[model samples]
Target: MVLQMSSNQANPNTYMGSVVASNDVVIQVNDLHKCYQSYPKPIHRLWQSFMPKRRFYQEFWALKGIDLTVHKGETVGIVGKNGSGKSTLLQVIAGILQPTKGSFTTKGRISALLELGAGFNPEFTGMENARLNASIMGLTREEFHDKLPDIVEFCGLGDFLHRPVKTYSSGMYVRLAFAVAINMNPDILIVDEALAVGDVRFQRQCFRRIEQLKEQGVSILFVTHSTESVIKYCDRAIMLDDGELKLTGSPKEVVQAYLELMFGSEKDTDALVKVDVENYKVEFDPSIDNCPKQASYNSGEHRWGDSRAKICYYEIFQNGAASNGLMQRGDQLVIRMWSLFEQDVDNLIYGITVKTNDGNAIYGTNSRALEVETPAQRAGDLVVVEFRLKLNLLAGDYFISLGVAQDHDVKDNIAIDRRYDLIHVHIRETLDAFGIADLEGDLSITLED
Candidate 1:
């Protein structure tokens, strides 16, 4: 496809600039833009070709004024809603698409696992396709043969590698593609939502390979809808919104902004009446401190919602006694939060979420999902909520998030009070476990002679 730029090169509205060069920089983008022309009908295209002076098509800019830089060994994540130019940007960087305006520079051999089956020939066998892809990535015949065993082992396609790629499943396609890309020893890797097609085990394996590549000083640009993956793997992240580069910061911060953009409403925070916490009266066990000063409370919690309700106090308990953030893996735990309402609200929902220290959500449930009835609350009403469950999770640092909202419907909910990462809990190890949760499998042995 041909790219066209606006006539005015020095327009004051444009972010016209160039990126500074550095030896450690693997990739640098400066004021990038990509535009596509749309014709109303096939006749319009013919007419446009004949009448060069007349405009018969409309222009749509898929990307505009994007600036980015990646240093060696850094993993940067791109996050956005659909049609946010994420794939377009990656395509431009991968040399599959040219920019309409602006410049970018890359220093090293690049390998990309972009759209599913992008570079594969369907008629070719999986093994043949692997060899072709490796050659395209600049590997010699001898070099590819040397790495063929590693590629085959990593993909685990086994006998399927000899079959035509057209017969491969989506998961198989991803496996073969990722295997070739990772084994190519690229200086820069660009992954665009390809791993989501793999099974859980393969995804874990791919991430491990990515970690190894990171240690070898490979710069990577990754794009996925999985915020948890971004937070867990990326050192930094950038958010794209409606073809514009919106925000760039830590992975957690960028994911938070992306989620807010997706779910946030324009409700006025000041319109909700504020509750006076000092005058709110509720009876609690005298031995436990429900205030924010409790040991389980996370001082750096992030909170946002309308001011109609407020979570005033919270506490954690184990075995009927208030406990700090530490607990055994199998212990039963209780989380309590007190919320004061300053206005009438109906169909209230109370929710809690358990997340890893890096913000990967482990478990979350709300009153609605549990079939618990919640009546309307009026001004000056105090509501206390308790969530109790066995800590079946593996030993790790975890955080608890709390929220209170008015369920308008299944799709729409009004957040009254929401606090993220409000409490920190550490699960102490007892028995050996491998994954996030212990399934408690029963063991049986069979003796054979």
Candidate 2:
């Protein structure tokens, strides 16, 4: 693997450079490109080697003209669909693979947990692999010993550490790997999807460690399919499409764009234009006359969709009366949403989500999950949906997101109309609860003679 020199030493287009000049920039990638040779058959590989320049294979570019910079303490998330070159870019940055055309520079020691058991020797014991990996990361014997206790405690592999790595389960493999990588004290951490293999407890532990590392000014490049994790942990995010850098921005914006790329269709724009014109002519129905005013509505709510269907009116009720955006904890509540269809649609799905003030989803449900079969509807038809449930939420401000979408077999639902955080509801104080929800626990005591 060749590391390109500074901009002065090499072509500016392909220069990776060291972190010598920039104090804050930890990782910089400029016009990076990577390609692989694809042969039609196994025999073609041998033929290509024998024929040399005689073109027995085609070039498959895995990365193309990727330019990125990671500042100190910045956690940049990489999100894309499968085969989008996420892993390829990371491998190049980690110096595990040589770039075919372009270059990228890294300032400090990088500890990457790219693939499961990637650096491990199957014949070696877990402890031996850990020592070898630590050494490879530039840790001395003293340093490795110093961190050994911490790694052992974190991984919780116990006696299994003496066993060959090939005998470990997928979860066990990630645990030991993560423990070593994080304990290496590198200035940059590159984590792929390896964290997904661990149990929830271990995952939480790893994230907590990652948060600590971020606070310590370690730049991190995280790649995952979980959009929620990106929104929750990342400062900025980049989306890739077909080996190309597509969009880069705040986490929410990038994730939204990625989702739109995945699930949104060209019809969305046309439907939105049509709905905007018809919205002015439509009048509110009398049934929802008591709906709360604009004060209860979230002005910063994000709304998008094809607009084939529009949520016209929405109201929340407690004790059979219109709610004023306030309700007691554990109160039985009713949520009503009215949608107007602008075009004929079938296999409709109505969904709702309850989220914290900080945008963490507490609970969500949809008609499809409840197995409610919805019939096809014609244009100009009005659909009213009512959801009745107990608001067992803790005392805090919460937001409700509503959506109407059409079912699709290949991907997620096609959004007819989706309103995120449209309604703001405040849960009044009640019996002490610790977390997001009140599970309503009961206590019993047995006396022994």
Compared with the true structure, all predictions reach lDDT values of: 0.83, 0.82
lDDT of 1 at 431: 60
lDDT agreement of model 2 with the native: 0.82
Model 2 worst lDDT window (10 residues): 1-10
Q: Which candidate is the best by TM-score?
A: 2
Q: What is the TM-score of each predicted model, taking all chains together?
A: 0.84, 0.86
User: Across residues 316-422, which tens digit of lDDT does each residue of candidate 1 receive?
Assistant: 88978899989887788898888877677788899999998878898999999999999999876787899998888888889999999878654367777788899
On a 0 to 100 scale, what is the lDDT of residue 275 in model 2? 32
Q: Residues 276-352, candidate 2, lDDT per residue (tens digit)?
A: 33343435652232234546788777778887777878878887888778888878889888887778889999999
Error of 1 at 247 (Å): 1.4
